[model samples]
Target: MRRHTIRPLAALAATGALALTGCAADDGTAGEGTSPGDGGRTLHAQRVMQLTQVHPQTGMTLLEGPTFDEEGRLLVVDVTAPAGEPKVIRVDLDEETAQPLHTDDRGAYTSAQFSPYDGRLYLTDFAGGAVVSLAPDGGDPHTFFSGDVDGAPMNPDDLAFDPEGNLYLSDSRGMREGEPLGRVVRIDRDGEEATVLADGLAATNGISFDAGYDGLWISELLENRISYLHLDAEGGVASRHTAVHVDGGIAQTDSIAVDADGNLYQALHGRPAMLVYSPHGEHLATVEIPAGHQGLESATNVAIVPGGTTAYLTVSGPAGGYLYSFEALAEGTRQSNGG
Candidate 1:
């Protein structure tokens, strides 16, 4: 398993905020913005909420799956917290407070999004290999979808919904080093069936629809890369190609969110920053935590509020889970929430 050990905050604070430049892949494609100090835009995020929960194994909390509901409430899941602890939480940005909404004895929910068709919050239980649902008020947790796909078990990490309410989730299981085992599965609107849109991925972690909803932007954590999959009318993969290959050093790519103009916000699991890329895979900007807030090193997921430029990031480390806010490169839409 990957290590979650927290490093010294003072050493991380010295780096300050960073501005990066994109690097070219071996195939001459735009990979990611790994070269720092390119004079790009650097925005410092302000902390919004801090969770007090801690995981016994890792000695710190890990947050992911940030999304905003139609009512503009910020929701996130604590992937490291155990049973009896708050596994899911709602944050009050103005008041800087959090409320426990759900908990489970064996569920390790890695992502959460509200379905457009059903108006219910859906969570991807990574540990249970199932998709769970809850009422808007975070009550009545239900098992929305579970079971094997083609005789193979699932390990869902993150999920997103299309305008028509079709569910798409990332299966992170079957990863075997050079032998990729991750896949993107699309469940029908009614949750009666599922189709594998793309497969042979390396630790698929994030999934989001494009601005036009004709394609999907997927992040492969172990590969440190992103891919764009053009979808056909039936939601099958029409064409797929590498998008952004990030060289994160000790960090790995986590959840991602897209802006209205097609800018992708890629979050890093072990780093204290987020890298923004244009639709064409061009590096746009780097959003980072300020010096004093560098203690929160796990910048794992981001959610941009629809119709607004404000972006909220879910970060956690030794200090605990936290929500931070920064300005995005473009306005956000429903695609901006939950990946």
Candidate 2:
């Protein structure tokens, strides 16, 4: 299924037809037996909805972010979706409706995270090498941070925040080739500047802070490993270690999200699947995308609803801009500010 030109907002605005088909929520949920109290890791997942199938007016070959706001709206971004069409969209989880919010001609966009404190959306422009931001209503796009140290390009992939309002980003300068130029950075409480936390990485990808703010995880794409960062009292990286290192030609790791109990849900590349691991690097469960589903190829990042047993995913590939919800066995770690 090559990417198609589905201008959903334009089509919906003209013809009041919002095609939300092929979406159903099932009772069988994931993480049923896999719980923190049980002292074990391993869970199952049941598909709830295939985004494109539910709303067939989206075309994206590169889909990534799936962050939600406190208002129950999920912010989804596409990179050169429909070939050179980069845009940010919002989906009402309550009503199951989709709408385009903003479009950028500057460069390919990768991720957009809604900030609770500032009431804005933080975005990563892969080609332009900058961290931009905007209002929740998709207004006033401006550069929040740009450039890089040593006068190099800023190739940021994913972003995460700590309990104290510090921001962390994975800089994938040369990720595709697994170059060691990748790095992990952190911003201060005022968001005025960023400092390098760790360097000499191999295509650093997704990132997530533990629920307790005790650890931070960074994905090393092409290397099939997830780096675990031990935090000091102030949330700085005290020690860095590889928590989940997949070998035997398994798969490449992408974005990651953490649950309340410190369970990490990671997306795999070589195939469409989700791998859950315990905090101790214990292999918990592998959730495989159902075949013949609406959109399963190129499954990338995941956003688990807080206190809700559901994990919403953003998938791309031949058919892009797909959103999915799966039965999660546990609750996701909520932000300190209740975002």
Candidate 3:
């Protein structure tokens, strides 16, 4: 395992203030608790390691989600200032080197995911309010779905794909001061689009589907709750409900990931811990991370590898960020249950 350390910004600005208010030091132990898992099972998560920093080739201002491609290379979206010039960075785990995958000339890119079916990458442009599809080899980006769905630019945030190749995105509306309410959208493979989903939400940031692909769950950063959109037989979102809500003042719940057993893992943006939830939206435990490195002031994204035994977390600091891997102790339980 490699360790990198970076420094946090001097001022306790927006990011720093949020971190201080949300996280409290723990005994450095993996979260211990039991919650209802998928099909009467129980789920748990322990903190294996805390990565101090990640070294990017070029400095990234605000980094968000990280997903792996077929080759296991990590692709991350960097949404910094200069508005129209966000970048996509690829990190090689084997060599510990980072390279630019793609750069935007139109707007800032926030979250990104790789399409296994087409091998293309799909990303959300917060400023442009659209989703752009780019070639994996890095080339010109095509407008897969621009939220100009009724004339106005729909504020697109994070996104996830279903088994049928349709992309489900979150359109966080209330961000521009006085605008429409936030809603979830679905885009077809052929570029055909529909606002099949809508909800009265606040800052709908990260989203993910269940392991069985039967329901969709989204993180409401402003409201501090995880919202659920039940899936129908036709793969359409049929209904909506609240999955989980944090009781304390830690409201900045941003990105989320799911284990093989259908348990949800989310990053408490304002806190240094990762919150784990059961399929029924029950808070099971919190994976506490020590506060030694700089970027640790903010933990942005959480991801579980395919085997379900390991997890990757992104710790963002002032200079840059790094990725940390954690080993899941209950790996055999998830594997045996076909998670």
TM-score of each: 0.88, 0.79, 0.76
Worst 10 residues of 2 by lDDT: 5-14
* Top lDDT prediction, candidate number: 1
Candidate 3 residues 100-131, lDDT tens each? 77765565666787764686888887767678
lDDT of each: 0.78, 0.65, 0.60
**Ordered list by TM-score, greatest first:** 1, 2, 3
Q: Deviation in angstroms for 174 in model 3?
A: 2.3
The numbered model that scores best in TM-score is 1
Candidate 1 local lDDT, 221-246, one digit each (tens): 77889999999998888999998988
Backbone clash count for every predicted candidate, in the order shown: 1, 4, 4
The parts of candidate 1 lying over 4 Å away from their true place are 1-35
Give candidates' CA RMSD values in order: 9.2, 8.0, 7.9
What candidate 3 gets wrong by more than 4 Å, as runs, is 1-60, 81-86, 175-180, 329-339
- Please report how far candidate 2 places residue 62 from its true position, in Å: 2.1
**Where does the lowest 10-residue lDDT sum fall in candidate 1?**
17-26
